[model samples]
Target: MKVELYDTTLRDGAQSEYISFTVKDKLRIAKKLDELGIHYIEGGFPGSNPKDAEFFSRVKEIEFDNSKIVAFGSTRHAKVKAEDDMNLRSLVDSGTDYVTIFGKSWDMHVRDALKILPEENLSMITDSIEYLREHGIKVFFDAEHFFDGYINNKEYAMKTLRAAEEAKASCLILCDTNGGALPFNILEVLNEVKGKIKTALGIHAHNDSDAGVANSVIAVRAGATQVHGTINGYGERCGNANLCSVIPNIKLKLHINCISDNQLKKLTEVSKLVAELANMSHLHNMPYVGRSAFAHKGGVHIDAVLKNPLTYEHIKPELVGNERRFLISDLSGKSNILAKAKELGLKLGKGSPEVKVILDQLKEMEKQGYQFEGAEASFELLLMRTLGLVKKFFVLDGFRIIVDTHYEELTSEGTIKVRVGNRYEHTAAEGNGPVNALDNALRKALEKFYPSLRDVYLTDYKVRVLDTTEGTGAKVRVLIESTDGKDSWSTVGVSENIIEASLKALIDSIEYKLHRTRGQ
Candidate 1:
């Protein structure tokens, strides 16, 4: 069966904490989702907020090749006619051919939330769908709290769906509003609802209990024609079912084609792109697209995967545009180094003496609280040194940094002295912090010798305390990520002094850039 994929990232997903989409963000994300072959993009509830209304008005200007835009709103108020309800009027005015509206499914909600009788709630749903259809809009009815409502009042829940069906709703979506329904219950209720209602069924699940994806898949197995979710499982409270997981599961595991196989390969890129736009850190352990999803760390697992990926992997990572990774740590073996070296374009044959030396060095460094897995630049430098390929770009003579606290504000100044071949340069600079000051001073010193250094800048800096037990004397590891417009690299350093650690990482960042630019 060909299942439809409806994305509510711009609507329900924005309800997630710390996630807000601007008009341009919504338009860009909609185009991205459309490129990923989403069937429908729920722009937002047009009448709920001015931003969403503006989004709908502006989204009409862009041409989406794949996905259809959906305007979301609630059912007409019990006290007003559907045609007179401003919410319904806004949905029509949004100029989207598809409209989705949620209505009260639980009898408790009808009485307490809407303050209306059960029949009147049913009338509200039917009237809203009828009104939208009369305006030549295809309506998808969201039976909010359908599972909970079914458990509380099966007859009323079924009647609500029947009302939507009688009003000729294009699709009937069962929403797990509380996100507490188990997969079994969802399957059972959906099976029953399938027999009761004639409209096409869809699943909209939340992740309060962490069963959102499971419930969504189970519903599809039972009988659902569409699945509604967010790109990264972003939503209120917990989250929505992650479409990143759901779409692949439907396509590969269930043998149902939700999106083309080529589009499936763009899953990882799309997932990260969405996270970047939302200004949220990507969850490394998220299924299918996460950084750690296909990573192998244990010696046994890494060996098995190296021999035959099927030995340790359930699915090929490349299928989802994610690559298998051999993580180097205390648990790493010779094979791991060989694979990593090969990946880095180094010609280190299996069982080479260089590999054993690098392995020994790595183990000793890891014992001293150095992590190479996250510091690829540091590892590469280590490999180059072991192979006798390292060339010093400059020699640091000395440096001094001063921190001043006056007028209730803290400022720092750094002075650096360096030698480039026979020429020496000394410079001083001030910055917001000691690291920034050091960076500024060092770059000023080297800019004359290596003008391309101006094109290189530190993009991110992270510090981790290796041993908190040491308290104030704990060894800190600094990881500096630098980008030279075209590429990015990460270098690591560890020392009891934070300044020394940051300087080591900074020096490595510069050397790596110089080495890539000039073979020497």
Candidate 2:
């Protein structure tokens, strides 16, 4: 069976909170979706904003391989002609052959939101679709709030579908605009639509009820030929359906072909790619395309998985371009340690004493509020140091921070002295804050010794209070992220003083960078 995949990452996804896709971001995602073999890519509402309008004009230059770029907008206004409707006119000017326009399907929406007669709403749907069709544009009619509309007034909702069908819409897309429909609700409505309508059907689902993927699959099972979704479920409110999960469920589980096997493997890659471009961290727990999706931390689970992957894994991690990961933590057992060591290219006997030492050290560190989950670089450094295989690079002699405030303007200065082998370098630098000042001073003292250290810079810094009951005297944990452009790593430090904790993490970050740059 074949199900068409339509991506709205550039359109509906931009409506997500804290997400504002620039023209370049939209263009980049559209190209990725096209390469992944999506049947349709909803670029954006053509005239919604200057940025979106410019996106439509700029998108025309890039040629798509397997996807059609689509313009999205709403139906004509209650009193306006489709020819003169600004939204409808923007659709024609968008320069795309396929266009998606939504119409109010719920009677409450017609009465409240549109403030028009239910009959007038139907005319708007017919007129907008027909006008686009007259210009040789294939229209995808989105029936907004459709599932709610069907339950409240089946007669009026069916009338709206009939309106679009009568207007020769290329596809009738039923949208769960509020995203509260369960599978049974969707199945019931789809069965009714199949019995009454002849036009091709598609489903646009949202994740408010957290069944976006399930409802989309149910719609496909009920013979809806098309599925609409965003890349990582990014959208207004909760989110739109996640194609990252929807596509895999439809292809691998349902045994349907929405995209080729090669394109399917791009799921994880594209998921993270879109997340990075959106300036959001990729969800580590998201199904199919997440970092932790196939990760095993339990010792028993790891042992069973190594014996037979089917024991703990539902599917091969490689199936979706994600690899299995064995996390090393206090809960890890001998099997976990061995497997993790093997992954890290550390040769160890089955019963090596070093393994127990590493495990014990890990547990002790955790007790002291050290979390290695997001600090893989720190974990590896600690592991090597525990194994007595690490080389000392530099030793910190002492460091001091001084702050002066005058007229409400504060200046922080950091002074540091470090011994590199037989030599010592002392440096001082002023900064906006104590952490920044220390970072500058340290780099100033080390750049001449290792110029590559100049390329290493802090990317993220996070602090957590471990013992909040102690209030001002609480121990704090600081996690610092550093990158040399091509690669990034995270390190953690814990102390009662925030500056001391930050300094510890900063020191680990530099050591990790030097260890990495030396190709060790």
- Indicate the residue-level lDDT of 21 in model 2: 84
- Candidate 1 TM-score, C-alpha based: 0.97
Among all windows of ten consecutive residues in candidate 1, which has the lowest summed lDDT?
511-520
lDDT of every model, 2 decimals: 0.92, 0.91
Residue-by-residue lDDT tens digits, candidate 1, 89-192: 99999999999999989999999998888999999999999999999999999999999999999999999999999999999999999999999999889878
Q: Which stretches in model 1 have alpha-carbon errors above 4 Å?
A: 406-408
Candidate 1: residue 281 Cα off by (Å): 0.5
Q: Candidate 2 — what's its lDDT?
A: 0.91
TM-score of each: 0.97, 0.96
The C-alpha RMSD in Å for every predicted model, in order, reads: 1.4, 1.7
